[model samples]
Target: MLSLQDYSARDALDLAGLVRSGEVTAAEVRQTALVAAASVESRLAAFTEGPFEQLPAHSSGEFAGVPFVIKDLLITAVGVCGHGGSAALADAAPAEADSTLMRRFRAAGLGLLGTTKSSEFGLSVAADQKWRGPTRNPWDPQRSPGGSSGGSAALVAAGVVPVAHANDGAGSIRIPAAHTGLVGLKPSRGRVPLGPWQQELMYGNVVEFAVTRTVRDTAYLLDLVQGNAPGEKYGAPLPAEPYRDEIADRSPRQLRIAVAAHGWDGQALSPDVRNAIELTASTLADLGHVVEEASPAVDWEGFLAALTTTWCAGTAAAVVPLLKSGTDRDLFEATTVTCAEVGQALNPVDLAVAFDQYNALSQSFGSFHAQWDLWVTPTSVGPAPAIGDFDADNPQYTAAEWVRRCVVPYPTCATSNVTGGPAITLPLAQTADGLPLGVQLSADLYREDIVLRTAAQLERALPWAGRRPVVHVTTETRQR
Candidate 1:
C-alpha cells in the first residue's frame, strides 16, 4: 500500500511511473487517493461531487493510475453533472456523454474521480459561493485558494491530487495557482479544445488546462490533451515539438525578457509580491537572459469596460434561460442577477464594439511581444485574501462595480486572455509567512513553448518542492 507521505511526495507523472513499473497497482493508488481526500474534506470544501463508489473507468496511458477532478464549470464528464456550485442549477441533470476535454482526459489514462467547486458560473475570483459557502485555501484555511478554480487549487495544493482540471477566463486557473503554490498554464486559445458542445467561451477569452505541482506535469498534460476538436472555430498553432521535450533543455536559449515589477494598471503590489517579482527578474538575469523593466501600452480603462460589457452579456445569456424556466431569481446570486440584467440591456452594437476592442488589444500585444520575448509580473497583488474579502452575494454592487472591486485587483491576468496568447503562473516565490506568490510569464499567441521552457528553467533554479500547505495530506496524516 502507498502511504500518505509517499503518495503526497510523488506527482502525477511519478505515480504513473510507479503504476507502469508494477510497483503498485492502479487500484491501490486510487484507494490511497480516496483516503487522502477523505482526510481533508472538512478543512477544504473543494468538491461539488464525489470520491464516488466507482469513478468512470480509465485505460492505461501516461497517467494511467493518477486520480483527477474537473472544475464544476465548462468541462463535463459522463454521469457527473456539475452544478457549478450554484443553487440555481442544484437539480441539473447529469451529462449524457463526455465533453471533448473529458474524453481526452480519460484517454490520457487519468482516473476521472469527481468534480470540484466553482464560483456560481465562475463569476468571481473568490470561490465564496453564497449557497455552498467558501472553498478554503490549503495554505491558510481562513483565506481563499483563488477561483473560480478554487476547489481544484485546494485539492492540488493539499496533495490530494498532484494535478486537476482548471480553466481561465480572467485568471481562474492562474489566480488560484498563484495563491496555492501550483503551476497553472492558461494555454493559447484553442490549444486545448472545448468542443462538440460549443466553440469558444467568454468570446475566445477563456481556455482550459489544469493546475499541477510541477512544470513537467503541466507540460506533459498539455501534450496529452491539446489539439483542436472537430469543427472547432479557432485553432492555435501546433507545438514545434512535444511540450515535454521542449522543457527538457537546461540551457534554454537566452532571450530578451521584459519585467513588470510594478502592476500595469498602477495598483499597488504588496511588499512580498514586489520582492518576488524583483527576485525572479534577478534570477532570470543571472541565468543569462536580458531582463529589463517594460510594459505593453494598453488602454486600461477601455479594456476593462469592454470586458465588463462582454462578461455581463454572457452572464445574462446563461441566466435568463433559467429564469424563464421558472427557476426562482433568488436562487441565483444577487451579483449574477445584476450582471445578467446589465447584459440583457446591452444593444448588439455594444457587444460588437467590445469584440473590436479585443482585436485592437490583440494587435497591441503582438507589437509589444515583437520587442520582448516574454513578460513577467506578479500573478496577484498579494497572496490569497481572507475568506470574507470578496462578497459575491452583496446586492449593493452593480455589475461594473463588482468587476472593479473583485477583478481589477489582479490586473495582469486578463491581458493574455484578451490577446489569445499563452500565459503561465509558476510558484517561483513565497511570502515570509509561507503563502505562495506566483510570477507570471506570458508570450504572444501560440507561443506556449517559450512559456513552458522558461517556467521549467525557473522550477529547476528556484524549486518549490519542499513547500507544503498546512492542510496537506502528509501533514494531516502524520498528525493523526
Candidate 2:
C-alpha cells in the first residue's frame, strides 16, 4: 500500500495515469485520499461532509480514477448536502440530481468523495462564520484558508486532494485560492453552466471553476468542463482551440502586460505583497513582455457602493427560499440579516441604478482591455488573517466596515466578475515570513487562453508547486 506521502507527490493527472497503466487501482487511490482527508479533518476542517465513505460511479473521463471534492456552495450532486455554510439549511434535503458540472466531472472519470465547507451564503471572504465554525489554513493552522470556497482551498493546500470544485462570485474562488497558494481560475462569464436551476448569478457576478496545483490541470479541467448546456440563459463563445492546447503552445507571445498592484481603496499593500508584485512585474519583463504599471480606471466610490448593494440584494434573495422552506430565519448571522434588511429597504429604482453602474464598469473595463492583453496584481492586500480575526457574527460593524475588514485586500477581484472577463491566481511568491503570496492575472472577456498561457509562462519562470505548507497531510508533524 502506498503511504499518503507517496500519493501527495502526484497530482490528479499523475494519479489517473497510474490507474490507466494498472500501476494502481482507483480503489487504492480512493483509500489514500480518504486517509488524507481523515488525517487533516481535525486540524483543517476542510470538508463539509465527513470521511468519504465510497466513490461515486465513474464516468468516461480523462481522469477516470482521480479523487476530488467540491465546495458545498453551488454545484450540486445527488445525495450530497449543499448547505452552503448556512446553519438554517444544515439539515436540508439532499439534491436529487447532479449539476451539469458534476456530470462533466464524473464523465471525466473523476470520483467525487464529498463536499467541502463554504462561507455562509458565500458572502464573507473568510470561513469564520457562525454556522460551520471556520476552515483553518493548512499553511498556518491558526489562520484562514480564504472564503466562500475556503474549505476547498484548505483541502487542496493540505495535499488531501489535488483539485477541488470552487466558484467565484465576488472573488470567492480566487480569494481562497490566493490565500491557500493554489491555481484558481474563474473562467470568463458564461464559460460554465448554471443550469437545471438558475441562469446567471447576481447578473453574471458568479462563475464556477476549480483550485489546483498546476496550470496544466486548470487548463485541462477547463477543456473538459466548459460548455453551454441546453438550458443556459447565457454562454460565452467557444475557445478557438482547447485550453490545454493553448497553454501548451507557450511560444513567446509579445503582448503588453499591465501590472495593477495598487489597492482598491488606496490602502497600502503589505510589504510581502508589494515585493511579490514588483518581482512578478520584473519577471514578466524578463520573459520578454512589455510590462508597465496600469489598472482599470474604475470609479472607486461608486464601484464599491454598487458592488455592496448588488451583493446585499442577492443575499436577500438567497435567504427567501430558506424562509419559504420553513427555516427559522433567526438562525442566520447578523451580517446576513443586516444585508437582507438593507436589500429589502431598497426599491426597484435603486437596484436599477446599481446594475447600471455595474454595466458601465463592464463597458469601461472592456474598453480598458483594448490597451493591454492582461492585468496582473497581488491576489490579496496582505497575508492571511488569523482564524477568528474577522467576525461575521458581529452586527456592530456596518457593511462598509465589514468589507474594509475582509475585502480591501482583494480589490482587483470583482472586476472580472463584473466585466465578464476571466481571471486566474498563481501561487508564485511568498512573504519574507514564509506565508504564501498569490498574484492574479486577468484577461478580457472570453479569453481564458490569455490567462492560461501567461500563467503557464509564470509557472515555468517561477516554479512554486513543490512548496508545501507547514501543516500538511504528508508529514509526521501534521497537526491534529
Which residue pairs come into collision in candidate 1?
A: none
lDDT, candidates in the order shown: 0.90, 0.85
Writing each residue's lDDT as its tens digit, candidate 1 over 194-291 gives 88787887788888999999999999999999997788988877788999998995678988999997774787889999999999999999989999
**Which has the greatest TM-score?**
1
Per residue, candidate 2 scores C-alpha lDDT tens digits across 293-358 of: 987778877887788788778877888667677788778887887777777677888888888888
TM-score of 1: 0.99
* Cα error, candidate 1, residue 10 (Å): 0.7
- In terms of lDDT, model 2 sits at 0.85
TM-score of 2: 0.97
